[model samples]
Target: MIDISQLNYSSADFWQQLTHLLAWEGVSDAAVTETVRNILADVKKRGDAAVVEYSCRFDRLNVSTMAELEIPLNRAQAALNNIPVVQRQALEQAAERVRRYHEHQKQDSWQYTEADGTVLGQQVTPLDRAGLYVPGGKAAYPSSVLMNALPAKVAGVKELIMVVPTPDGEVNELVLAAAAIAGVDRIFAVGGAQAVAALAYGTETIPQVDKIVGPGNIFVATAKGMVFGTVGIDMIAGPSEILVICDGKTDPDWIAMDLFSQAEHDEDAQSILVSPDADFLRRVSESIEKLLPTMERQEIITTSLNSRGALIQVADLDEAIEVANFIAAEHLELSVDDPAEMAKKIRHAGAIFMGRYTPEALGDYCAGPNHVLPTSRTARFSSPLGVYDFQKRSSLIQVSAEGAQPLGKIASVLARGESLTAHARSAEYRLKS
Candidate 1:
């Protein structure tokens, strides 16, 4: 049912084919940046009034005051109580796992004293407040609430503010329930560039946040890009991605559905399968045809596969690793025999789903690793969202009189070489008798 591109490692044009597939055509055009610029400027100037007006115009919600947009704790708690028992249990379990995993990632402050009495180390501290932006237009992502807020909480963030748009005043109880479970300090019923501006610039009702984290639409991404220097932001994530390296041992249907999991995200998301078994590649393609009709988002998956997906035939697992490293996919699943051994060869990937039993969907939800990962080959240099992202490090230094004797000379030499007389004099003044 899908017409995904097929490539073989031995082909002369394989590199060109791969490069063409990797290209991202959605450059933020001048019109989008101009619109984002206008929104940011308007929100900055008018504050709460501009935010309310934009919400009314875009979300179709007629509200006059900021208090009407503030969601109370009782409402979030009520949502938590109203959800189905099974869903609640699953959410609690996932939260517990995510919390447990992140607790290990928490950094601590330490220092060491040298013989000359110089003390140097790093002091780790959490941000004062964090803003979370969860997409609420098409489908609600409660997992996002757990993923973004829990890490901030674990990192000792003083306060957490969450913003989810209620289009037409329709709020998703699952999202509220997850926010309640995640311990979000405050909740706002606004979204898009207006919400981002509020968090970046601080409106009358919404306090400014030190960093904003989560996923959003193109407009929200643009706003985050524009306001990054004002307030820290998580990466401007591209479309979801999943790359599977199969050794032809796992079920072809599982591989087909694994690809579908990310492809179903949107028409532009990418899904790739690299395998040594050429016949297995054909079988998986047939499985794709057989199973594509059963999916609810069949149209999206089909387009994504046909446009951005690929089934590559490599000579061996080693060559597959080479291709995967070059791609630096957002989600890489190793459906091979010795996944741990194969993983040592991979240097670039946002997250690695080890072994055939592990699927990328588990990581998206209950697997305890952050689903907010690097995309567009940024995995080559970037990392996943974690407790460390919400925390900062300050270099600590204290030079005793004896210690300054040697350090002052070095500082003076460096400062004079750079022609900074004020710095050289300052260091010279610290020299010991």
Candidate 2:
């Protein structure tokens, strides 16, 4: 009885309907924007005092000073030591895999000397410090700690600071353990726009970070957007999305659960299945109905599917790919005999999970790929968070005196053409008369 939308490719208004379904405006309302602005301004002005005040007001913490809000590294270590053996092992394994995967993304500095003795190259360097935001309290996301922190650590960031909100003094042991495993240097019990402001502008206690990465609620996202130029930030992600292009050969139950995986994230999360076989789509719909009651997050799954999920009937696999490219989903699954072949045609997607056995959940945890991906059709332009996000490149150029002559003449002409007399004269000075 799930009221998921069903779309037919042959329908005259199909494209329009699809477009409407994909549209999601993630802009923060004026009220939220203004509130974030005020919070940022206050934190910038008052430093630790404003942060402490906001934490007491918003997080309901009984604290008088910034010292009370800081969580020590030994606490994270203790949490790691005390967690269940199996859970600890799982965390270690996941961390190792994530570390190994990001190591491949580590960039190195390179240089070369030209025939004219002009040295030109690129130097790669990691950020001095980074800030990570984790959702805490009732929600525990250890996987997020691994995905965001490991990449920065791998990129050789000198310090990694983590801020998690612990409402009413509630903290998740697993999150603390994950922070220990990920090597986060400092931990602060703060959240919302206030925490973001502290990271962007620097409180007396919290050091300003070169870049801020991780996920949060509407307020945090709004704050990140507002302070983007002040400090680098990851993309403003929208709700999670998964698009499955099936060949009607995979088990309907597996495919159904795959779609449910993203839907369970929240009511706004989108899940769509595209296939040529009408019978397979029907079977998957039935599977969704049957499986709904068994899930602990059944209500959330149901609401998500009913509101934004879809089961689309396409003319063939080719049409399905066309729809996928148009949607530019965050997670794309090609559940077919030849997923590799089909993946070649995919021009846009945050991450592609190939074959029937592969699911989006695997990528979210231990698949060795980053789960921090672009969402809300941003996959077309942006990419997932990786070691590269924590690193920067600088162009290296050292012109030899002899090499400067020809280059100086070229620069002089271009500068003069652009009516930049100072630039032209500066370049002319290096030229032989």
Candidate 3:
């Protein structure tokens, strides 16, 4: 049951209430960190032996050697072929859309020559290799496979390695099919912190990667954070979240169902709605009650909504937009009379869904936008994972004698001001020569 209040609440009060409802303060226990640190240290110390041991202990699989870890190419292909035609078609379509979107993001190496004979530009290059971590325990998300690998493939990464846990010693055929569609170079049957470690520090089997992307559990997230400096990581993702701004025009059942979509993801997942209409709020509340019992994941959804879901009654749509901005939700759905018009006012969402037809689930699967988005309040400063994550940009500068005189003088002055005599001399010598 959602509490509805229309009184003029201050920003601080609103924030406090939202925080309480959403459980903004995450689990702060050090057990996850301590465990990950110990695992990382073990991997660093014992190498493959440590990983193999952890694989058996945590993943409950008997993977003793590198050969056992490598998923055979033929096997992956067979898995792809075995999948249903409709599912394969869906995965292929999603892959194409993701590739097309990322292809537009690809940057070319460029050079520019000034009138003074100075050449300056930028060089964009892809990393040598990338690792994608796909979660396997709770559910299989081939969508995550496309979201993570397509960008790296479009960026022209030389090698793409994927690691996923398979407790039963069998990987999901759909995941393999999706990987094949996305041009994954290798698939390793490993997961969790050990899988991350195997990617971070090359094992006898898994190759070291330049960058790591994808979503995972808390253990995986901790491992990624631990090995960040050693290898490039997308971001330490938090729980899933969705915020809807409704003007009370749409059916409350639709709104209630949409909010539950995210809530069912995890107990910490946040779902919120900001509406001005009292009737709409009451209807949505009733809708949630009626709908909660019908879901297969009803228990999970109920726990999540009870702890993190909310329906706020704002003064108007403008106030709703303000509240949304302050929250900086990962997924923002504008279900207003004019969704496009309202979207212009939103500046801090990871992905904006406009109109009554565009649900957040569409973006999660096949809407051509990466579902690997910044979660929690990080949408304020971060962004959804994209092609840029797989590419690196280098500043290009070349100075001719004519261009060197002016630029070198400025550089020398700045270097001298910073008291770096060697830097000043380097610029001065370039100008003189």
Q: Model 1, residue 72: displacement in angstroms? A: 0.7
Model 1's lDDT to the true fold?
Answer: 0.95
lDDT per residue (tens digit) for residues 269-376 in model 1: 999999999899999999999999999999999999999999999999999999999999999999998999999999999999999999999999999988899999
The candidate 3 region of ten consecutive residues with least summed lDDT is 1-10
Evaluate residue 312 in candidate 1 and report its C-alpha lDDT on the 0 to 100 scale: 97
Provide the TM-score for each candidate, comma-separated: 0.99, 0.99, 0.95
In model 3, what are the clashing residue pairs, if there are any? none
C-alpha lDDT of all candidate models, in order: 0.95, 0.95, 0.85
Total clashing pairs for each candidate: 0, 0, 0
List candidate 1 segments past 4 Å from native. Answer: none
Residue 176 alpha-carbon offset, candidate 3, angstroms: 1.3
Could you give candidate 2's per-residue lDDT for residues 2-53 as a string of tens digits?
A: 9999999999999999999998899999999999999999999999999999
Scored by lDDT, model 3 comes in at 0.85
